[model samples]
Target: MHLTFTTLAANQTHYFLALCLELEKQGYSTSIISFHEESNKLIADAGIKVFNVFEIYRIEKEKNLNIENEFSALLSKYQIECPNILLSHEKVTFLIKDSIQLKEKFVLYFKALEKFFNELKQTHQNNVVLFQELGGFASIVSSFYVARGMGYDNIYFEPSFFKGRMFFVKNTFESYKVQENFSLPIEPNVLAYLENARANKTIVIPKKDASHYQHPIRKIVNTHNIKRLFQKLFSKYLSNQKEEFNYIGSFVYRHIRMLTNRFLFIKYYQPIPSEKFVYYPFHVPMDVALTVRAPLFVDQYYLIDYISRNIPNGYSLAIKEHPAMIGVVEYKRIKDLLSRNDNIVFLNPDINNHEVMTRMDLLLTVNSKTGAESLMQGRKVICLGDAFYNKSKSVRFVDNIDNLYKHINTALKNNAPNIDDINVFFNSTYSQTHIGELYYCSKENIAQSSLSISQYVKANYGK
Candidate 1:
């Protein structure tokens, strides 16, 4: 068997390489595909073939080749009907913006990615397995699309209901489909993992730095952010390239938002009302669960407005800001939301999420990780968007905005915690996924957890 690992960033560095090392020990040939040269060096030292995506793209583009023609050919290779997955990109609509020039520019970039995928496919044609962690980026999503379109067995880790646990699926669609019939008792491993999270206060702690979700620190240390700052500065001032791929704009925007917060002195975050209220935890605008699975509710402000206006008369609606989205969402937008909505109150992002969920009357979200966590905590959840747990037939899911009232009523009426479904879901999930920490959490799990790659590949792919 051949295992190809693709990833980006330092956070993904150790976890992915750990997986590769485990796979190698299992008698499978392995290769590493990464943007980070640092990670590539480590993998190369391990005697695995390492492909740096950026360098490969640069080298491949020098050849006498028409990218558009190659891109079209690549698309033709995938016969299955593809949905408009491009719309899932975070800033795609804004980038194109009906501008012919921008559209042309994006296509130029897209063609290059398609060519890279082509090169990648040709190199690994004999491979029976492909492991990827690139669905987060728009450009890299193309590679996953191509890989899946070619019908290679796919697997990726998604945030599970628990803090440390991650949900793995062979195919995206398969995760959403509930089993017809099964008899699997709740696993002890699942219980142990949750207890460890409780002991560590994992769910209770508000994740200050997105980069170090698992790493706990005594004081707020932002070495990761500082490193990113230096990288952006170098890309902007020292590089001096004509290409618009410079990171200055993003860094500048971030700095501006930080400055804006200091000067504004406008506090919108309110106490989680010690009264009856339903909570709607805001999701990061760029989350795949929001953009890909729940496009209708991507415009969170609008969704908040709809909820504020239409929430049942008896209860107040509480909204909490997502920690990572503090600067990304404009201060004025948040201010205007609190100012306009009489029944709506904003909860502080720093508040312990576990406590908030425990106290809240009901939880509502468009497929957020927090919402899933609420389900595990035995809170009544009303998911307005598509979720893997939507198949559980235990939680309330609203298909349309108009049905919010109905769903809310249903969820509130069936307010008792459905521990049975929670156990069943975890057991069903454990059967499909192996216990391993990737990207975040205990490094011990990565080293000790059994590799599920070969088993998944064999079950999903050919002999």
Candidate 2:
């Protein structure tokens, strides 16, 4: 099978190239359709056919015609009339869609992609598969559009870990073997592979760098005045509303008491007091809600107030700031609500989520990977909203703050979490066992979904 990879981001490098290299080693002809000059250079340097679309458009004005015409030129450059299966990055496709206009520029790129897909359909016909690396609404939408264009029944979205530098070498090899033996028309087979593939994976390298998040050090030096100024400026341009700075100032004042506990310290590495409290780690990117005419921050504050009124007199709450959004806003509203009752504490952090999870009594969060990690550690995880990991029977989710006191009473009264249950859950979600051989078959999998020579011609020439 032969494969073509088309992508635009000059700075971003994807696993498609590596996947192509592996396929080539297994005796398949692999080529690249690079959108950027730099990427074309890299592909050529690697001794592969490099279809430099950007350069072609630069040098030839005719190439600037409808995207379909430019696409035909690109296909001709690569000597591919049609391909068996055409694979491109979903994110890049969406970025291009959003970046271009539908009249001329959009039509041009669409034609290029359509030509590529049509060629695949003509050459390979029923063998085309569109793959999504990051499975989300956007990825699914992108796949739907591409599948419609190519008339492909087989569409697949693989796990994020199985791509890039982090993919397990053994797993890829095993998948290759399986694909070689597997029959054609692989939609159902691919779906089955995805279900089992999750548990069959190994931790080859630590997950991609945790450095992608906001630094924790910013919390210490960012005083109330600075944060207030930021709040004013943001409210003017981004969110034209005033933040209650005084409330936050008072809230930070009370957090100074956490210093009493040597082991319970927050960002400064202090200790936490052995007090019974509910920990809520706020998740962000909710600011996007404003675009849809939603008042997200206000709703969050109201929820915090409800929790403050309902929690029992002696017990308290702990709120953790999202690592991504440290200085922009504070959990002061939640803090002030709890302060009226003197039962809520906000934890500052100098470290990462792994360390924070270890120090907590119970984790209360929304849909986050932390929910999964907490369950893996056999900790009490309470999810407040719909997150991917919330469907577990092992984790508790509080939908309403009105029931917060009752639930806490019930949990403390019983606290019946089974170690065996935790072990079973962990094994189901993360444990890597038995299916180590599957990784070796990765090449076969690639080949099975790969496009053949004849398929490319039909997709492009509208045969």
Candidate 3:
């Protein structure tokens, strides 16, 4: 089997590489087709064949004509034959554009891909189209249409989170001992443990994101044609505290039941603590202010300076660039912006957001997933604008520089949130099964096959 992984950026390259090495170890050949130079270098440095799209030679030519001709040439080179498995990385923005325009780009890209595969079928009929974590709404819906139109039978979709019984099964068995009982979901031992934990409030970690809101209801309200009508309806209905609490209360009930009743507990839950930090996660379309549509301009550096200069002398600010934004953001520009502030501390790249937020006293974010996670972790999250979790007392939503400073000061003295409270917030909102179920896959098969890959490679290809 020949496997090829396609990507523009190398954000999830490690995950793809792990999958590829597993395949190669199983006596299969693997290669990477990446558009970025950094991606190619990383794969090649790991002893994998890297097929680069545009390189030094391609860059030598003039801009427009060069990119057009080179892109065509690159496609032609790969157009020879289809591989057994072709996995596409998540769709990334080639350039920033309006959301409406971005949707058009997505449509065109998929349509072009549809045409490519339609042609590829003539030579190599044995091809599978696999997409990694349908990154966004547009991409997911687009892939569904493309896959159906092309009639490519081998289609696989998986969730990107780590939640479910299967999750703890593989993890617990791996930690303790693998057993046949672990394979079954209705494990009496596990249920008893989880029940006990819930009763004692021992397992106070965060719940899934969707549990924080009525996502489907919100989606309908936001996406419907008559926005004004729904806005009025929402305002009227939500205005009543009883109605609103009942609405939110019912949402939490489902997750609380599922978690306490279904999933088993393990003794290995990671601990999180309270500390203070300035978190600037990388989000897209240049100005996150636009995407977030917040009432203020969220200049991360400005926020950092204000915090460092005004937040007294006792608090420490942890600054971290989004893991995915490492190459995208010019760190030099950011460094230059913060050159005057000695109080800013950059976090280690490998630090998990979950762990970091748990220990942090407060999290400062514009509109990032970390903000949502921070809210769920029961940390005092100070949002500068309309983040997903901007509604909580644990969260202080500000609209401008001066207001941000005001709220930051307020948050410092506000009530501390316990982990159980965080759980309640998350449980009362989003649907747990939507994204959580996907993360809880049975990875035992993947792991066993992966381990066998190295042995198989040595047996077939020699040491």
Candidate 4:
């Protein structure tokens, strides 16, 4: 059996390597299909076969044939549409004007992956793919399509309900664990962990970038992005030119937008803590939660319009800017876009998340962890996206704009938090989750994570 690691970054390479090495001890041949050159060398150093994209890129160039058509057909066949938000984001300005370059890059990527696929069939036995996240980004999404099309089994490792724990799911957008007779988490330690997290009211920011953005100055100081600084400055002055350095302009706009949001938040978005409100914790625009799972709900402003019109008379719609996007979007711009009649109140992002959840008359989310966390509190949640907790009776699922009003009324009027349901969900999640943290975990935690991976493989694929 070949354990092929298809991880995203060089930072995660060590952790993926740890799993591969542990499995290697059990008669499994190890391989890595990576974009990072350093990761290729590291895997090779560990006596694992390395399949780097540059190697395939080299092969493609030597072919002297433009395989862009073939690559486009493959992407079309897989229905792989690169996220539109990428072209506009300032940090990674790969896609600006002439989306042709973006398409060309992905075409070559898929072509390299085809070469790698051919090699996998000839050199490996019982091959399987491992990914941290699929269907979220461009290159990774391309890899997922290529691998799945070639008839390989994939384990899409997902973050479990518990922080630092993980579980296997078929897809990121539509995964729901079906288990009956729910009880509290079987592990005493796991239960304690949840209790502590709830008591302290810690918000789990999904991406490392988001956690860093909490303290923007420290994030900037630690980051060696001076090159981007100049790029942002020059892109603005060269706006008349075709998208050569538009990322520079976009970058400059992003920081300026952040400052603007801070100013707007103070000036216009002041929400009295004592007033009745319905919470809608905003999400990172780039996340799969919105882009992949809830594409229609991508425009929060539209949903806000619906909520503003339909919410009960006394309850104000309190929306918080997603911490991840605080530095990216202009909050004042969002506020000014709405008419004065839209009974809306914007909450400061810095406020304790649990306080926001607990105080609100109702918590509405488009597939956020806020929904799950709210449910754990026995609080009724109005979920707009397909979420793990949508099945809970306490959660009101809204699928259409026409029905959102009815659903909100139903949830608000009759739904009360069920402590028993919360306990059951919590227990089931812990009992099923493989104990370990995915990133920044201690050595012991890594070992436990590897063991969890091994267990899943043994249970599902082993003879």
Model 2, range 374-430, lDDT digits (tens) per residue? 665556776665443455577776766557777766655556456556444433332
Q: Could you give candidate 3's per-residue lDDT for residues 1-463 as a string of tens digits?
A: 3434444333445545655666766655665544335455578888876644333223332232333444344335434122111111111122223343333333344444454445445544544333333233233333444444555432222221123311111100011111112123343443444345434433222222233233222332354324534444454366421111122332233334323321121121222313445455444323323222432343455555666776645666676545433233344545664467655666553456665665677777776656765665456776665443566545667766665566777777888666544444444332221222322223554454344333433443353
Pairs of residues clashing in candidate 4: 184-427, 185-427, 231-248, 232-248, 378-417
TM-score per candidate, chains pooled: 0.80, 0.50, 0.39, 0.84
Q: Model 3 shows how many backbone clashes?
A: 15
lDDT of 4 by residue, 1-463 (tens): 6667665455567777776777787766667777655456677888777777766655566776555575558657766565343323322332247655555555666788777777887877446654554345545655766777777766666676777676676533365553534533356775676678778887655333344455444434444566545544453355322122234445555555566556556655555457777888877665666766677776767777677787877778887877666644445446564555456877777776787888887888888888888777667788877777777655777777676667777777885877766666677766666766665546787678777777777787772
Model 3 alpha-carbon drift over 4 Å, by segment: 1-92, 95-310, 324-328, 351-355, 385-387, 399-402, 418-420, 429-463
- Strongest candidate by TM-score: 4
- Please report the TM-score between candidate 4 and the true structure: 0.84
Each prediction's RMSD to truth: 4.6, 14.5, 21.2, 5.1
How does candidate 3 fare on TM-score?
0.39
lDDT of 2 at 178: 11
lDDT of 1 by residue, 311-387 (tens): 77878898876655544455777778778888898776667787788888899888876766777777888878777
